[model samples]
Target: MERLQGKPFPAGYNPEVEHVAFTREPLYFAHRLLIFYVVVKCAQLMGHGFLLLAGHRRYVTPTHNLTYWHRPCQQEEGSIKQPPLLFFHGISPGIWFYIPFLTRLGRGREIILLEVPHIVTQLSFEAPDRIETVQSLAEIFALHSISKCAVAGHSFGSIIAGWAATAFPQHVKQLVLIDPVCLLLCLPDVAVNFLYRSPPTNLFHRTLKDFIDPSSEITVSHALRRHFWWYQNICWLQDVSCPLVVALSSEDDIVPSTAIHYYVQRHYRMQEAVKHEKEDDAGEMTDQSNASGSGRLIYWRGIGHGQMLVSLKAQDRLIAAICKQAVESGLATRAEDIKNSGQKNLRRSRVTAA
Candidate 1:
């Protein structure tokens, strides 16, 4: 059975959690929603949209069952070597807002984007059991005939991905966490700043908070306050398997990214040391240091949470991580072809496989 004991908030988080009152957002929320809704609609009208993707099979929100959209590989299976991507999105209205990022990610492989209603819908009073969430994900995996896949998640979704990795190790081949809230969940930062903090007084900050930031919204505050359980959501690096990449944005307003960056890097180095001692051939042990691209722990400077949704450069960086296996595979095939053709290229790029 899963533990129900929740981590306590630091004294600095708030004087009293139950007594703390929430602030009202500006009236522009409705207007902003309509305009963004139009933008999503326009993005749909242009050429392709996520809604049209196949396999919507009766997605029910109340029971905590997840619905997924799969984008199959356009290329031959032999040429594409990357594991199938099982993606979980962060707190957002819907998956429509993430088309650009997902589109770039789906270039050469099967990508399954799973939808989370509890975080996005705000009306859900309880987040599903982590075990149940992974079971729901397994259903999608079975649909795609995928036994093992790389799991990638953002923010709230990262919590689910971490649970999946820890709980079902055999099924999760790799993990990529971005702006993840689950890493240092025991810390008071997210709950205190995102849900319980007072609204910004400055006009510009107020506008940014009320209009752009979902954390400033009343329902989001309620969702985190009532439904979020810190201990249940927390993901410790000690529990995870190998080939993990943690991407933290230095300017993230929600999660304490700098702390997370250091924490993850230190954990990986420690894990490498432990593995090295166990193996007779220490050379076989994986190197997960900050300098090693394999098992990378990236800290993106000047980037904010959810900025990758629009920024192609940010998406490309993440894309490189997600598609690392494919690039390596392609390079290997090129080298093989060059060798067969009798071309003498003395130098070859060294690749450390995850």
Candidate 2:
């Protein structure tokens, strides 16, 4: 496992400012319609009428789940409070799965959990783009008078979080992507196309009664299409500008470990080149520099993909990273101070997890 500072590849790419055209194949329309039909049918069977109401709901007021912890004394002197954080969760049971990390990582600040609306609501995946997701989050941020905040996403959620960071660079102070599946390194072209059309048994339900809920089928369908799109359009990552931390599980079965390594090594090379350039200009040697500002890659040994959210030790590392990011971004005064605060909570959490 390795943890190091470096810059993300394709530097100077800010998704919010750049304009990129998204071209969908004509066949995709048919695929999208079929997914929409499944979603609508599921919602109907579940007896959710609100989801049936059309015209994309733009404004959302997210409930603020805040937890207070010890802040560094330096922060008490009226320094600008650090922006809050918003978390986008992966495809799983739901946001409930993230409660452990939320309580620990959210200490001394606010952490927002935004549910993928389509997962619960009978919404069509075709109607929304990454920009719309960002806007929807912006509405929630505005409700709390938060002009800027960090964003984190895990697995499937990482794609949305990355898009949000790309579309709203100024608004996102930092970005955390964990075990992202959209990198398209693990699966082949044939596999992605096949999965999109004919999903695996894990994704499909033989009977509506067998489903946990109507949204179950829709979530799986959406995942297939979303991942397929990612395989085609890989330019989004080039535009992310804020501080980034990518955590990869070596044993991940979904996203190829090679893809994660490629991403980390690319940034590592970029940072090294920059350091050399500095030395050449100064005509002297110097100590190493921290790459946390540009990007940081964390390789998790035992953890599998997004499992860090639920695991105790992995969550400890994640909280430390979040606190470290706060300091790096000037959101906090001292990395050690914030880290200590989170550590104390982590100790208490150990008892709960046991």
Q: What TM-score goes with each of the models?
A: 0.73, 0.60
- Runs in model 2 with CA error above 4 Å? 1-82, 120-127, 184-216, 226-228, 231-237, 275-294, 335-354
* Highest lDDT model number: 1
Q: State the lDDT of candidate 1 residue by residue for 1-354, as single tens digits.
A: 124456654456644546323233322121245565465446534423344653222343234555566766554434544667778888876666666676666655667777676565333435567777867776666667877677888888899889888877776767889899998988878776676567778988877766666654444545665566788999998787646778888889889988898898888778666665645555454533311324666677888887767777877787776556334423113334545445433332222221
The CA-based lDDT of model 1 is what? 0.66
Clashes of each: 0, 2
Q: What's the lDDT for all of these models?
A: 0.66, 0.57
lDDT of 2 by residue, 145-214 (tens): 7677878888767877877776786678788888875555334532333333243365345333234333
Error of 2 at 10 (Å): 38
